[model samples]
Target: MFEKSYDVAVCGGGIAGAAAAIASARQGKKTVFIEKTVMSGGLATTGLIYIYLPLCDGYGTQVLFGIAEELLLASLKYGPGNIPNWRIGKNAEEAKRYRIIFSPASFTLAIDELLVNAGVDIWYDTLICGAQVENGRLTAVEVENKSGRGRINAKCFVDATGDADVAHFAGLDCPTAQNALAFWVLEHAKGAKWRLEGSIESVSMHADGGSIDKKRGMSGIDGAEVTKFILDGRAKYLARLKKEYASGNQSRTTLFPLTLPSMAQFRTTRHIPALYKLRDGEDWKHFDDSIGMTADWRKSGFVWEIPYRSMVPVGLKNLVAAGRCTAAEEDAWEVTRVIPTAALTGEAAGTAAALCADKGISPDELPVTVLQDALRKAGNKIHLEDVGLAPKK
Candidate 1:
């Protein structure tokens, strides 16, 4: 039985996993990142999602910050800015800011460089099959790779598997829903020819393939980014209709100008559930333990601070969830799963895990307020005061 160990072992090599591994290692933990695939940057990098959706909370607020944001910029820096408007075609300005949205291959390289520079021991092409728990502690994680089945042990473990695979296998309390749409990461091999009749931006979304949702709501948004604006706007409209007890019958919607690069891009799904959802109702009104903030197309269009408790799993002691699976109801889950928030949450989870390891304490026992304070001290913005939560258009 091939056996290896680390001070902290991070499962999943996606953005969250990468961020967590780097954060823990940066903080002086002997960290190892285990990824099932040869390439890193699971979704954003491997998935080839160039633009960072809702990086800023509604109202132009930057809710999540730190290494995650750094990586987002690093990835997006290769491309042009998000369309000028959060809504498709609407933000002609954003489309102009960035140039040549980068390929997923480039992103993989960037993430690899970042993690390697941070001194993380990354194991590629390795699949984690299960966990070995003893005395309420995870001694090692079972994995299978080209070499065969073996075990990788660690003092502290962070599950960046957006699906919360480790937590679920370890029998931890997690949110579950049957009909959640799987996020399909399609290859954008075919160059796009977006259809734009009259739009401020020069490009429009292609009617054929590509999954990036546009924000334009009025209709006729042929651009990926612009259309996501439409979809978000449409979702908002539906939510408003549902709120007013009115029928949500939409006859049609149009596409907006495409984002930069004249290429197809899409990533997202719906109906995903959460273990500990953070609703804007009484639960959130009285939430004292804030971890981060998020925004989506809903009544609460503004971003709200996420409580640290939300990040901490219900039963897991050494592990923490860092991506869309972190903890929020269906509605909130949709928004939090966005690239930037996922990355940021991963960063927080990783940072918190590293802090716990440094203090020789359990993640649940670590002082959350202290961790939040550290996030801010490290030039990571953590307040709604300076960074407003407005529509990022």
Candidate 2:
């Protein structure tokens, strides 16, 4: 096996992984980003989940900032989406929410550009096979690519695999949740009047054979389960198209799938049971160690302070979890798994990893205030009051 070294090694290349790699590299660390596939934006781009949710509380204030906002704007650079002038103090109704619908391909290109600009060493089509842990600290990750097996030794690591692959590899206790079936595809339909500022339109098949149903769900962590989930989703998509054609209302030429999701659209998989798990009904709550704030994308006037403790996995010294694998449960998981919160937590984890590497310390050994200060200096609003909002009385 070949040997390599870096200051920070970010596992996974999705939205969270991209943000982590960029944040670490920007902090002057030698960072390497590893991805199992060629694409960058994970589910957001490859899974056809292209909506960049919201950055605002949905009432009238913008809550998320830094890389979350940067990626949202970047998503539109090569795609079709618009950001309302929310910075000018227009209300949500008048200015519209801070969100956009982007082309997945375009967002992939933009993410690659951002990664390159940040001086991140990127390894595409590389799969993480194992990890090396010593004295309760992660040391290096074993990976395989076309170059064969190799070991990437880093001072600190960020687990952004969405499925908690790194933490699981390190023998950490990771809890999982079932995901409802959802298959979103981009199609070209003749006279598709409700197109989303693009020539093509997105169509979805949900769990109950409808669109975006969440009742019946299944586990996504097992290998066979993943295979069946994908196959079952495709079968449902095929059934939908067959019905459309049989009705004599649409034909292959009139309406057909332009692109299918290259990855499974499972919403939640596995996550670390961190030091602090953000649970349901914590909306508008305050955390003294909050690294940043994220709004509830599903509804307006609801926000949550993301605790730095939530990213720190127990019994691990140099590893922090981000994105869907963070310590958020139930309704909180639904909020943190989206694009905005993924980037938010990704940036925080990456910054913390860099700080740990620089100081030759572990993630838990580092002070939360130091991490919070670094994040705030990078234009992130760490708490509710930082954005001129307060917890509900």
How well is each residue in 310-369 modelled by candidate 2, as lDDT tens digits?
A: 899988889998898998888988888899999999999999999999999988888999
List, residue by residue over 6-48, the lDDT tens digit for candidate 1. 8888998888798888888888888999998787887665544
Against the unseen true structure, what C-alpha lDDT does each candidate score? 0.60, 0.87
Q: What's the residue-level lDDT of 63 in candidate 1?
A: 54
**Worst-scoring 10-residue span by lDDT in model 1:** 180-189
TM-score to native of every candidate shown = 0.71, 0.94
lDDT of 2: 0.87
* Prediction-by-prediction clash tally: 48, 0
Tell how far residue 252 is off in model 2, in angstroms.
0.4
